[model samples]
Target: MSASAAAAETPAATPAREPILSVNNIEVVYDDVILVLRGVSLDVPEGDIVTLLGPNGAGKTTTLKAISGLLRTENGEVTRGEVRFMGENIANMAPEQIVRRGIFQVMEGRRIVEDMTVIENLRLGAYTRKDGAAAVKRDLEMVLDYFPRLRERTGLAGYLSGGEQQMLAIGRAMMARPKLILLDEPSMGLAPLLVKEVFHIVRKLNKELGMTTLLVEQNAKMALGAASYGYIMESGKVVMDGTQADLLDNEDVKEFYLGGGGEHRKSFKNLKSYKRRKRWI
Candidate 1:
């Protein structure tokens, strides 16, 4: 083989890099009265999908808020530890500054402006960048390519169906060209078919676009299927952390979250009794 041909055939060495986002032993308290998060920590490496799976009020959303610097809204503050993004400490950074550092979030409830056009809403997501007009246009096209429904509803956002609204919410987040995107319940309150569609797009984004994701999901089964790693939280604490397969095979997870025959019913009865006694105390 010719030397030039051999050189062309050789693969370039991929660099070993640290996680794009890292949370270390963070604690959050609200109004000095309630503790919303209890020493939570997680990591999202480049091109990997990590999921936080939990029931309601498990501090899933609170953790995301802390990472995004939105904890101040509820008079809540991170009292311990750090949130590192790209080797920089983001624990005290402003929300806009956090976004500028390539972390974006598609909050729960598909928080799109119902009164605005889809295109206009998408434009607002890129407000942090000043000189990315051409790049933004390209990125918009990329988002449309991923969510064709958004392309069709370019002129209408308020009138869209629930599924389309969710798509637009995700597409708007993509317009920022973030390296890592935090998705909070993208499948909430949707039909089964639409849930499947949203998960399809999510997996495609991680695999094809090389985008790292930290998904907070209530649907444990579906989230496990889409994510490579998972952290299971209960009452503001991470109870289990493992690979998707490990979680699937876990006897405890199957008994509680995955619906293992009549066992969960028995467990629920015990939980109810415990709660009743605690309330009495």
Candidate 2:
């Protein structure tokens, strides 16, 4: 064989690229004294679902705000580390600039304009865009295609169902063509059926549309099931970080977060008793 043919048969190895979004050692403080996040770090690669799981007051929401530059009003500051997007530090960028940089946040509560028409609300999402009218129109149609209920009610948002409102919120975020979307409790305050629908849409967006997501959810089981990887936070600190299956099978996680069977609770109590007896001895 010729040397050129031999060289052509050899494969070239390349190092993996960094994640699209990186939150490195971020600490947030509100009111100048009330600290919310303590060195929270997370990474979201392209086309993956990363969930932040925690009970209330775990600094999940605050982490999202820090990434979007919306923490300043609450007197919260990064204070320590930086948030990097596409290899650029965005900790000091303005919120508008952050959106332009392809990071969009769908805040808690769905936050859709109650009185505006569905189209109006969607239009507001694209206010940042200047060109590509035809492309924007095509994207809007595509969003409606994913959310057909929104298309049926495109003339009215105030009268839509809870599920429709959630759909609109997500569709609105899509209008901006974001590279990574920060979703804060998309299933909160929804019926079980509606929650399933919302999660289905989230999964579809991540899998079918190739959108990277950072999800903060109180519903631990559902979040872990949908996520590629998960971080469990407690009192502003990450207590565990692992694959979904690892976290699901963890004894401590099942006892505390998953609310496993009564047998699991009894086992925890027995373990505690054993520890106490050993200490006494």
Candidate 3:
């Protein structure tokens, strides 16, 4: 066949890959009255670290809870829209069901069982999986390799330092062998060096293990550095989203989140109106 004829016979390939996890216009309400999330939506592609950045009370943590089905514990519910994991609508699924479906959430505040040994708390993460005991044992070693400090503090979770606690939280999530990991404020309350180390591990896992991660964080500088894409939420809605480069270069994000705006910086409190925040988004 002629070159032109061969070109005509070739079909165009789709460029976009399907997302592993998607939150579509979800609205979360608490105690039947307080509406927290207002139509927030985002996507996490397989094997990518997608950062969800927002200030306190921006519904960032609430979004993670809704995805992992942890909202029920706090009397919060996704009243509208859908949370789809691997093309399955899981908005109404129980937390354990979500975990069983290969989603694990590393909640904020390091919710480790104080009395349990570090290894014991981690073992609980794999409880929902029917995988063989050997697989669980292997993953335990892998988790420890990722956070060696946990190996040293095998006694009790209560004795771990704040940074060690955060590491244990993430290590526990890894033990579940989750397809998607929802990390809430992993850098919270950690020292600068430890914060960098934590992000390094998160990035490494996403690359080495092909793990899909949705990271909710306030540390914009570090988060963007590790993420492939980012979404900025405010006042219960996703106000902006873009590739990491786009967000890092944004003037408003620089001034406010990345600490680069200098005198040009503006506080989010002053930009309550969407019109004011739209310039950078």
Candidate 4:
């Protein structure tokens, strides 16, 4: 057989699946003067956990707010580019509309309602649902199943411990039954043990519920472990991105983000602020 014929007989590789969410070169500005995100872009594949990692003030949280349309509430605007969810342009949409369209954001600091009961806070997540009470009730039970401790908390949500409040925050997002859940610093302020438990549940949610997750975390070890892919941001731009293994194995990543660099390396503050390896650029 001829070489051309032999090559033609070989089957082609399967195409990669489309991402459920795409942030395409989005630029966000606060109060029409302060530029926070500069041409940021990322993709969240369906039914997979993708993580965004960076130091404080790297514009990670702002990226999430832009997607969930909470920016308008804070006088922020997406001045350029597009944010597409499920192939629809949703940039600058109202927050409520974004929630109704199956996108929910669990804000940082576990923004559970302090005065209300745990059940009330969870139900508040369903406020945008047109589904009947019975459906909402079923999801409420489902959320409690994931966080059984929440089931036991009948009193005010305010009184719960930090870990329990984090659980409540995640449970509330589950109540929305969203197609995509944006988790900002889910590991923040939790004990080491509690952080492990939370990441375990996050993995479980991805596996069993098939929920597509976009996670922003400072805990690089935990985040990269749970995520299939990761993006590292610096100065409002994605400086590096790769599959979990690729990122975990990179020398710069290991030294700077993973705490693996030896004594010769200076502090992270000096490294981050003053220096950039040529490859990173």
User: Evaluated with TM-score, which candidate comes out highest?
Assistant: 4
For model 3, what is the error of residue 205's alpha carbon versus the real structure, in angstroms, after optimal superposition?
0.9
lDDT of 4 at 101: 90
Residue 256, model 2, lDDT: 64
TM-score of each: 0.86, 0.87, 0.89, 0.90
* Collision count for each candidate, in order: 0, 0, 1, 0
Q: Model 4: clashing residue pairs?
A: none
- Stretches off by above 4 angstroms in model 4 are 1-15, 261-274, 278-281
For model 4, give the RMSD to the true fold: 8.2
Q: Judging by lDDT against the true structure, name the best candidate.
A: 4
TM-score ranking of the models: 4, 3, 2, 1
Candidate 1 — which pairs collide?
none
Better of 2 and 3 by lDDT: 3
2 or 4, greater by lDDT: 4
lDDT per residue for candidate 3 within 1-281, as digits (tens), equals: 22223222222212287898999999999999999999999998877788899888899999999999999999999999999999999996889999999999999988998899999999998888788999999999999988877888857899899889888888888889999999999998999898888887887787788888899999888888788788999889998998776776777788678775556545667667744637433
Show model 3 residue runs off by greater than 4 Å.
1-15, 262-281
Candidate 4 per-residue lDDT, tens place, 3-82, comes to: 22322322221228688899999999999999999999999888888899988899999999999999999999999999
lDDT of candidate model 2 versus the reference: 0.80
lDDT of 1 by residue, 74-146 (tens): 6788888899888888885677888898889899999999999998888888888766699888888888888
